[model samples]
Target chain A: MNSQLAAYATSNLWLIIIGMGIITFLIRLSMIVLLGNVKISDTVMRGLRYVPPAVLSAIIFPEMLQPAPHGVLDISLGNARLVAGLVAIATALISKNMFITIGIGIVTMWIWPFIIG
Target chain B: MEHSQSSPRREFWAGVKSEIPIAIGVFPFGLIFGSLGVLGGTPPLIVFAMSSIVFAGSAQFIGVAMINAVAPIFSIWTTTFFVNVRHVLYSATMGPKSQHLSLGWRVLLSYLLTDEAFVVTAWHYDNDNPEDLTHKHWFWLGAGLTLWVQWQISTAVGVVFGTQLPESWGLDFTLALTFIGMVFVTLKGKPMWGATLSAGAVAVAANGLPNKLGLMLAALTGIVVGMLLEGQGAQDE
Candidate 1:
């Protein structure tokens, strides 16, 4: 293990990692101490509320539908994620529940894959 | 009350319960992170360490993603930076609740910081009296710790046995579902929609960018687009 790590290491990898960690610690620490407890302006808070959904959806949607190096749509029907996502949204709107939204969407996405595959 | 017998334990479980909703959905992502970490040759200990010490889902993922044959210092820093910008928002929301806390407690909260806990704890504050904001720190610790522990255990499983698991068969969508739950709960108002749509468009359009620097561009664009739409929404209202 020692030999393998030495083979992988170059000059001062530790310095780089440590420096990066310090910077990360500072960014997070500053945010937590300074911004964590303050009341944010309404516009900022409203904008913040949207970040997770947007980021998550952007990550998920493209991963699901895109057809790889061939550049084709993955499904004409039975794209479990698309179907389940819509279902999840509908469930969320109707029931306003978290467990159901995830449970239904996951079960649906998991099954649709096997069914289609 | 039975709670009196084991107050700390009870408190700990209460913390877990508050986080359980997010956890059930989170376990799969944890498994994916673990498997990827193991496959990427991150020692089981380091994987565990990152999850415990860093304790940020996206950052851990980004770290493993960049554990290449020769990752430059700046590259690792850049990736972690983009991955955790969301924490800035998490911190802003947590601000008022910690004003009465000592600097030590503030530092601990920063270590235990997570977006879900921030949302849940902050919601509790926004709806309840700020004076009653005691013990939420405990809950945040419990939730983040459970996740940290689970991430390591799952990663160990993946590392020790990544070879055994068959084709992934697009199981990643379970993660997508978890995100759907979060997005649905929070996706209201015109600015949010505008920001979200623009970011999504950017993410897809910029898919060609190396190492997905597009994620950062998309997020920055999202912040601006959201603020702009908010300006518009305010006018209409």
Candidate 2:
């Protein structure tokens, strides 16, 4: 139940909420607000282009390689997520369609457990 | 389609139409956030408000998870901020296209900006003729608002039906799949492949790091690798 967490969330809810709102707002407004005056360097812009792939891979890799409860590393055929992720990657490469990639990925995950069992 | 370039109304609708597919893709993510928030014991009102006010999907998910873990408020703020630092890049990309806009329009557009909106608007700006950009902010507006409205609605729906989804459905994987699709579509060259693989390797290597700092390290490593590759090419030219 985490009474302390409940208390903290209840008491400071507005502050945390408003804090996140302002922080996110400012980040979104940063370069836009400074528009025309400050130019992002070409090198920096080049790096910026990698942000999506990097950030996305950072997010996705851990999900597949390290499944929760903190310590087991799963890169084997037994890891359903890893297998489904591979399937999704292939689907994405072949079709270049997000809908199909996600659809097949989900179906693979659903069916993987049954096959493994 | 051609008429949209002239009238703001038409331009706005075009943006909405362009965003429909993105919105559909985002809908489940929004629902997942709402359900995650509720399952974490956050108040429904707070979940609703945060979804509308904060409006960044991944950040909101992290914020709620942090709160549930009883993490310090400051750390929560910091994590969310870090998670959203990517928007600084998005804002920079959108700046040239939107700079001519009025203060009010800029402010509203900045507020509406999201990953989906950025993709749609970036495509429009890159593809459209330079002469047609005058009213293109309307297209940005349309796309941003479409995602905004859809996010709020989907979040509310998730909160209402929290935890009802069967565990076997593996809905969370869809988010990752969506990101994979994004990664695959955006991969145009060797530098991108290098960036993605290096990031994944670093993220896996740093899996045990606390507070998801592994993600930050991975992103930095990827950017650096990509930039180095780009620098090598630029020098040869």
Clashing pairs in 2: none
Q: What is the TM-score of chain A alone in each candidate?
A: 0.52, 0.80
Q: How does candidate 1 fare on TM-score? A: 0.75
**Per-residue lDDT over B97-196 for candidate 1, one digit per residue giving the tens place of the 0 to 100 score:** 5666778877776766665555455544444343455555665567666655666666666666665654444445656666667666656777777777
True contacts kept of each: 0.45, 0.78
**DockQ score for model 1:** 0.41
List DockQ, one per candidate, in order: 0.41, 0.63
lDDT of 2: 0.81
Model 1: CA > 4 A from native: A1-23, A35-46, A65-80, A113-117, B1-15, B128-136, B186-195, B207-213, B220-237
